[model samples]
Target: MTASPTAIDPAVTGRAAALDWVELSGYPTRRNEAWRYAPHKKLAELSFGPPVALTTSVPDLGDLIPALDGPRIVVVNGVVNTELSTMTGPTGLHLSSLLDARREQPDRLAVHFDRVKSQISDAYMALNIAFGGDGAVVRVDAGATLEVPIHIVDVEVPDETRNASCTGVVIELGAGSSATVVETRIGVGADFGGSNIRTTITIADDASLEHVLLQNVPASHMHLSNIDVTQGANSKFLARSFNLGASYGRVAYRVDLAGSRAHADLSGLFFGFGDQVLDQQINVVHSAKNCTSRQTYRGVLDDASTGIFNGGIDVLPGADGTDAEQSNKNLILSDRAEVNTQPRLEILADEVACKHGATVGQLDESAMYYMRSRGIPAVEARRLLINGFADQVVDEVSIESVRTWINQRLGHDDV
Candidate 1:
């Protein structure tokens, strides 16, 4: 017998109201331009039950990446596991559970919570706000520079319930503050369920933040994520994403340059093997003058996998001196694989400078042949070429451990 969708806890009145509102608004369909290429039918048909918190042993991270000396927070099945987490750092760096923050520091959480939510009209984000579970809250005090990186690990435990899980994160960087955050999402078993994650980030004036996201879940699970960022004057934000696992995954980013001279750099590398489907959407809006934005994305598709990249840069009116660039490149390794890439730019300001381009093609046969003719095995040569193609984005990663881990995951040594 199959399980049915579970009901929201009546005790949680706020979540109940949000869920009601989401249901009334309805989910996205193929007719929606933003969701045209997504697997709308599959998502609409899936019965997502509320997740049940479970305590399980933490998995080893040694095999995934090098051991870094820093503070780490772990969340299992949408619930923060305090026992498994380690925190040792300077003062004024606040890291705690979102729920705890809300109860303890309601004033601090009020302004940042859902600040960018209104700018986005996505139904999934509404669903996350309604039914989302526990997540992390990171705040850096002004003039505090955290030398060590902070890691937030989200793990999905195998269960027969087949429920859906949601995680929400809020990050705030004060003026002149600098920090790095790494988020890793991993799954444990074959019977894992789906996940919905929403993150809201705000960088104050003169602040800097470096963020890295890794999604490595089971092939049977579905994943949906939305990231919204707002930058203040002269602030800088950098983001790097890695999508390596999932049966169906969609990641969206919305960045707003609200302050003059603010800057943002976004890059991603995705590998779609087997029958996986990966979709990425990025939208950057220059609402202030003299803001700069750059985006670069690369993908590798094999077997019957499918990949999609839709990136857009918009320079609004009166935003003079805006500079923006966007590029997406994909490599198709198998005839059965498919990819769709679109790069768009809208310039309402005549004084702005912008360029957008995309390319979708297979490896160069001539290069492969040349390597093979030089005594290199054909398989090894193909691997080498593929690695070289992906290295362009990997090499941009500033975190040494993350770069090394990604290279190893992509079979860099074999190549």
Candidate 2:
């Protein structure tokens, strides 16, 4: 039986009032401009109500935690996994559970929680804030540089009935602090459908944060995520995402440069095969003087898969001396594959230098021909060219081991 919307826990009732706001805000129907390119059938029809809490043994998640060697935290089905997680951090780093942290550290929660709006009226984002019960609260103390990256992985365990899960994460990076964080979503074999909703992150002044997301959900799953970040004065933030699973998935990533001399970089890659659909929307807002931003997204669509990229850069009035650039590139390896991209720039400050561009096409025929001329097979030739195209972005990852792992995952035989 499909769960009802009222299935939410009564204990979180008052706090759950936000879920109603998400539904009432607006459904992304076919007519909606923002969602027109990406259909919301599963999202609109799925029973996204809360799941019934039950005691279940935590299954073994091998090697996932060690991948994040630094201080880390793990959450399974929306609850913190203490056994597999860690609390040791830099002197300024504060890590705690959302519920317990709020009770004990209300000031920190009050300062950063929900500071970014779902004002864009995204249904999934609103629902997350309303119904999400358990989550992580992270605070990077000023001038503290963490030696390791924080790894957060959300897994959907096998179950007999279709289930809905919501997880929330709040990361606050203080002035002059630097850290790296990786978020991964994995799906196990299950008889029922799985749906997920998660939301917001905040970066403070002069701090630096490298955020990476890896999603490998099952083909029967439906996932939607929205990440909003606020950059303080002189801060630098880098955001990278890899989406590789689910029948339908959408991610809305937004960054607002609210402090002067701050900067933000956004990069992402998506791979979709079979009947999968992956939609990625990125928006960077420059609201302060001398702030800079850049965005680049690449996608590989195979079989009958489809993907979309809408990246926009907005420089507000009085935010002079801003510099922003945005680009979207796609590789379609199959005739039946499809991809659409929208790269937009809204500049109100005349003193700023802003540019945007997009390209949609097949593999480089000439480059493939050159490789084939060397007696290379057509399939292998195409793979070589595609690998070269994607390597530029993969090279940006700093960790040698992680970078090597990512390259191997992308089917690259050589560095």
Candidate 3:
């Protein structure tokens, strides 16, 4: 006889729900508003085979991993690599693998799987829920404050036959806790198989978190991610992100400010060149009173590259005294470069403040002329201008090592 609902195993039930979702909801198309600016052809051509276990030795990072001194976790090809991961100097902070959690504490990830499904119904999320048997799990205890940041690294290794991998990450912070976390995603080879990842973050009341996300996948890889966040009363969330590499890379964020006096400060920089297609989608909802959010993103495109930034801020009917702002700036360095930016606001509350703006333009020729007149070479002048444009977001990164790493990816030596 079949087990009752209370007796059903969480892992099996979660996978069954995910399979049902996969069968019911297929991949998104261009007609879908959220995917309107996405590269539908590239997304369509992606081949998601099965998850490949790591059989060979891992390759060297070689300047890809940043210089960080903290507790670290590494996920390779949708599986955790214990040989390269370390946990130190942080008490009350815990790390575990998704496989272990499913085996021992089945309720941890099963709830998040259901939460993500309730919030969004997408093929990538469904794949992640169904095939994500291994990854990283991080949790901080109540009233614990960590000085060192936790670094989580994700590496994608190309398979001989070109397959796909799916992974999941879940971060939780208890009440009155404070910590910093960094996430880095990079690929090993040029013939990279696609990787789909899902991340969920939950912050309790009066907690604080600082986050950094960097994606510099290989040239021939496709990187897709879904990040969902929920904040409690008086909690604070600060994030700085960079999307500098990948042939077809996209990151979507869904943030819900669920409690009064919560605040979110977020910013990102997307620099593309060499026919790359980079995209970013951000949606923030103010669900409680006196919650505030700000989004500032910049894009720099060169060669025949394409970039898109779609951001929205929504204030619900009961969310009075909400304040939100959004800004998107683009810089095109080549004639063939293109950028599509849209920043919008929707308000159903009477007493709320919302503002959004977007601008797309080229370098200041007059500034270039002035710099050239002052003995700065044309190439150096252009580099300086582009660096200056991107520094606005880079400077917001609180960590110096991450700042230097991002500068290197952007081809700038210094901040």
Best by TM-score: 3
TM-score of 2: 0.90
> Candidate 3: global Cα-lDDT?
0.83
Q: What CA RMSD would candidate 3 show?
A: 3.5
Tens digits of lDDT, candidate 2, 1-415: 2233344233344334455565466666768655876656656655554543424677667633226567767667666677867867767778886656756765656544443344545666656655566567778888899887887777765365466567777888878899888877766665455546464677778899998877777777777777878899999988888777778777778889999999899888888889898989888999999998989888889999999898888989999999999888899989999998887778898699988888888988888889999999998898888887777777776766556656666678865
Clashing pairs in 3: none
Kindly list the per-residue Cα lDDT of model 3 for residues 1-415, writing each as its tens digit: 1232223334666666776787788788878766776777776676553457665678787699788878888888777888888855489799887667766887666667764466555777786776666777889999999888888899988766565677778889999899998989998876757788888899999999998889898979888888889999999999777888788788888889999999998899999999998889899989999999999999999999989898989898899999999999999989999998887688998789898899999999999999999999999999999999999999998889988988888789873
Better of 1 and 2 by lDDT: 1
Instruction: For residue 55, give model 2's deviation from the true position in Å.
Output: 6.9
Candidate 1 per-residue C-alpha lDDT over 366-403 given as tens digits, one digit per residue, 9 for 90 to 100:
99999999999999899999999898888877778878
lDDT (Cα atoms) of all candidates against the true structure: 0.80, 0.74, 0.83
Looking at candidate 1, what is the lDDT of residue 224? 83
Deviation (Å) of 122 in candidate 3: 1.4
Q: TM-scores, in order shown?
A: 0.92, 0.90, 0.95
